[model samples]
Target: MQRSEMPSINTQERLLAWALVLVCVALLFAQAPHGGDFYWSDSPRHALNGVFVMDLAKAMPFDDPAGYAYRYYAQYPALTILFYPPLFYAISAPFYAVLGVSHETALLVVALHYLALGLGCWRLARFWLPAAPSLAFAALVLWLPEVAFWGRQVMLEVPAFAFLVWSTVAVVAYLRGAPPRWLYLGAALLVLGMYTKISVAYMGVVYAALIAQRDGWAMLRNRHHWWVAALALVGLLPLAVLTLKFGQANLQSVTGVADAVASRTSWQGWVWYLQQIPSQAGWPLTALGLAGAVMAAWRRMPGLGFWWLGFGVGYLFFSSIDLKEARHSVFLLPSVTFFAVLLLHTLVPPRVGHGAVAALALLVLATAGLTVWTRPVFYVQGYARAAAEVARLAPRDSTVMFSGYRDGSFVFNMRALEGRRDLHVMRADKLLLGVAVRRELGVEQKGLTEGEIADALNANGVHYVVMQPGFWADLEAMQRFERVMSSDQFEEVARISTPANHKAHETELVIYRNKGAVTPRRRGIDIELKIINRRISAD
Candidate 1:
């Protein structure tokens, strides 16, 4: 308890914190996402968002980003840029420009966020738990299945939640009397998190409640809370306006689209996330986490307001949303780890000392680490090669029509072309079909008849017909288009094969050469945002 002893302990803690960070780096290098790491349907879209930014910067159209973005989307129809927030892309753009657009380059950004997740969680845990338990719990949480799975992929959730964690930690530190300036730091991080993904905005309610309760009328009367309002106007107001335009589907997922799939009133929305914890995080951590949550709430622990309120409010907020996915609940991991470490510290007999807890945690981490040390799955990357072939053989400024569930992947791969940026990719489903796939199928009348499809194809100067058999086979229009591709108008020139995608139908990408004359033309894009709850009448 001596003041002099505090320096040595603080130094040791600092060393341990950085040491844990170094371990994170080692983990990234040792088990980097390989073998279709970016093959998940949404993975490539995340990568391409950054590519769009990188490509835009190269064109130097700072004054005309909207025009540039439309051109970029015209070239590749599968970008989810504005649908998601712009921070992740904005941050990754420079790296993409420096490293060049590849999955490896995109994944490097994920690795950086992964390190932040570890260090941020550890820092947050230090506020609630002792040094040993804090470091151990921080490392232990990352070993959770969902955390590791998300952090490994080029996805927005990990980075988004990491920023939220840092923000939460900073706000709690300020509440604990760290300094008034922590408010600014916390506000800045929260804005980054919100700009990374709008979902992070939900937890703002929790932070607001804490600040209101803590500061009372004096917070407003004294201007202690002005930073958050200032940040919201500057950072969030514009994002909110832009998202209204580009992220309409994303916004609807909270209510109409969300309820259509899993009603907000349904137990499925409320329980699905909790059900995932046992499997997503092992049973041991689940039990410990539950116990710690109870303990923290009962004791009214130091950081209980932030951690427990986050858990309770986060659970209700996410569960009430009509759109439900396990990833949406990843923000709850910090609370889970906090409570687990709380009980872990409690169970550690003082006689045995905290060092024993540290050793035990390391032991558990070492064993659990073995399980995630090697990421499995062989290469499922034929889409990139198909893109190369399309860029190489297709006439300059021509269109390539791709029909498959992974149109985003192909669009992403095509964006990497060196000299053929003029070539455009049109998704067959969007071009020829006006059907709803989310919640339930609402098949409108035929999207396009055989003759209409052919006319559209010719009008758009589609010189290459690439498709995976069985894709949209149920649709009458695709069937009609299939007949068109099968007829004498197009000949099967090359079969670009790739690994079967997601264990679905054999995805040997069949590329057909159109016998008709190649006409280069510009045309308006037909964008079918998926969360449209209404049916589209056949044209």
Candidate 2:
């Protein structure tokens, strides 16, 4: 009411705003360098896309691997892949354009992912909270051990989340009688997400549901919405071009694969759902998010509530139908945290906004700081150290195999070997076979026994076997394959292991030289990596 008081109020608000921006920038920069590294990041696939785009940029020759827009390169949405390549490549283009391919450039791209995700989180928080609370919430999401850590990886999770949050703000604004940018941007981002991962197709379901609520059956009565949908479809054109040029499978085949998997494990859906809530939910975070979502539902904030419910149900259902992996839960995390923060702010009044902001900011900074400093010691540094030793010590022609190659293929593909091709690398099929067990039995499966493993090894012509201490719960079980290496394992040929990987089934990678009779030599090594889709397993 008073002139001097007004100035004070404005200054306070300005400080809050500046503080929020500063927090976001600081958190993002903390994850800027090696912080993005994950054991089995989907980075290789993202990096491959960057490579493809670079091919496009340099006017290098190219080919369409698949003709179907959504079915190419593993049934991913063509548009999603097309969308991120340019974004990712731009960050790495200068270095790669000069030095060719290097992880250094990938580090830069992942850092950009941090920045993008941070911006998106900031935008989304603004829609729900006051300036200080909103920014603090964004920082909280950014520094989440999972979020900050994986956000920097060469993966689509952060990018997909970034787009989702940006579009959410846009769409919610429009629904509140604002403008069309939200709807358009949201749709574009949704399409982008789909290309990044087929999991994003769930967003379409969310949108359709939202529109139906807003306009009733009348929503479908208007062709304008359909036109918008068509535009989104058109946005997928470049991906379509890529698919066609590459000779990829059509969308029908892609969905067929999904359908088959769903049909096989339709029964264990609920059990899988229960299992994920504990591990993937981030302990207290999931509990907090769920509690918050309930409050939102009770408070008539159904839009946000529905978003969480839909994500949780959709992700759980999808996980059940296929195989469940930690990474699959990535998209559901933001929604979980979003609702959690919503609930937290609601429970705590703004009377203590300054204190609350400080506490939350301190938590995030502390977690991020710990991760940044210790990540190399436990995660990246360990892997790098192990990989370096393996490269240096393992015979050049010795086939390198990951004892527990769950999702660890990315590390195997990129890190296990240096720039030389003399090393023969092979991943054990026993671990990968878990993917197939769910499809056939309608329940989660474990790795194979010794006899089954022997058959698998013989069939695949595995020359070197890697195992950790935990990999053999019963050492007597695997007596068939003589252990060539042990705790001594060739004098720390850097038994490459990751920190996040539990000691259970954690093989120290005993390089058994396959003393059993070998299969006849062929003209070329026929290496078939076992594939286990929930509905099917390729032997």
Candidate 3:
């Protein structure tokens, strides 16, 4: 290889990288949803939280009281705002204020995060690969199905990771003698990442390992590093306090008391995450990442070694947790993609014609771009229409019930779309389980009888019930639902059916109206009744 030819090769690579960046951006915009309908259950809830923050900031009345209706398990029903750290919501709040609180505005916030993710990954990759391959690597990472799927929605994974990658880049730069300021910047970004999602705290382990390998125990002696560490800790103090106070409440809010019923020691969680790698990261990239890790180990490449460590430890740590989810693998994707691209560069023989290599890279990019563009949008189409119907048909200020685990879409649409804060929207299951409700209604601990359930609904002034068949698939639930439907106390109001799709629980929305308030019959003679009978007999 001639030294003179190196400059020309570098120039060509730089041009290719920028071109890939543009292509990735174009694909993302093409795929983004332009409507107010949310695609995922959590997205609408998260967006509503942002709106909650926005309303509070502006001194406006909280627009959605239904958001506060559900109880976090046996604990008293409280606002849902505290379940997650507020960084993502805080950043999104202003967008809601300016753009108007809608799914489109929430998506705008996600798109900004998406752009940051791509740029952050490109910058991080530059530490190892040249300009061209680093940009190409960023494009490939962005095109991964998980990234594309989550990036298009208002979710925490992509936004949190954008800061995490940039933080990694900053730490690497400081270690390579960029400047002391880089270390502080790295520390600040790490704090932001933690605030975004607590899962990113594992990055600190990677940072510690990298420093130890580079300078043995001596790096700890550096005052600048200690100051940076202190700053990060101070930055995290508020979050630490909040977590200590509300951590259990937050966990209960999401998982509920059912976490106690589910098997926590099962090996299925570990297996599930292992199986996701091939689909989450395409098989081609997964294979390349494995090869890259082996080659990097053989060559003793410290940078790649640190990445492998981060990826391995993060994967194992999350997999060991009882709650298994594919989205948790998102943070590990950047490291995996980095190694995959490194392997690609390594395996491409220097003797191979430059034009051939260029063509292969372009081919991969084109295929990925097309896949992302054609990917199905998974919005709940029925909820928007159902919400509109409810607003139009149901009397203003009437209590309405939603019976499902995924009721966020309904709550979001009723409040955000219809702007109906006067309506008391409740989840039937949550209402049944809520301890406060039981105390208020003087209901029995053993559970409500079919008659008692109807009595409780009427007593609470619930005028309408929205039932979804998929939510009542369990035998007991279905039986209860049937009993409620058969009761003479309620009449069928409206039924709306949507086109069949796998994303929603039920395509049919059945609305039932309370006919007349019926006094509930006591199942057994109460002590008060017994006391009255004895007094009358004695008299």
Q: Rate the local accuracy (lDDT) of all candidates.
A: 0.73, 0.51, 0.66
Task: Assess candidate 2 and give its lDDT.
Answer: 0.51
lDDT of 1: 0.73
Candidate 3 colliding pairs: none
* Backbone-clash count (model 1): 2
Candidate 2 per-residue lDDT, tens place, 281-364, comes to 345666777787788778777445345655765675465434444555666666776776676666765477565565456545
Error of 3 at 142 (Å): 0.6
Each prediction's RMSD over C-alphas, in Å, is 4.1, 8.7, 8.7
Candidate 3 segments exceeding 4 Å error:
1-26, 32-39, 60-79, 249-272, 350-363, 366-377, 434-446, 473-478, 500-503, 517-539
Which residue runs of candidate 2 sit more than 4 Å off their true CA positions?
Answer: 1-38, 41-59, 62-104, 152-154, 234-268, 271-291, 299-320, 347-539
Query: TM-score per candidate, in order?
Result: 0.88, 0.62, 0.81
Could you give candidate 1's per-residue lDDT for residues 235-347 as a string of tens digits?
A: 78889887886676776767657235467777766787888776566677777789878876687655367776787898888888887777678888767766777786776
Number of backbone clashes in candidate 2: 20
| Residue pairs in clash, model 1 | 258-322, 258-323
Residue lDDT tens for model 3, 428-487: 655444322112223223356777777767765567777776664544544565578668
Name the better of 1 and 2 by TM-score.
1
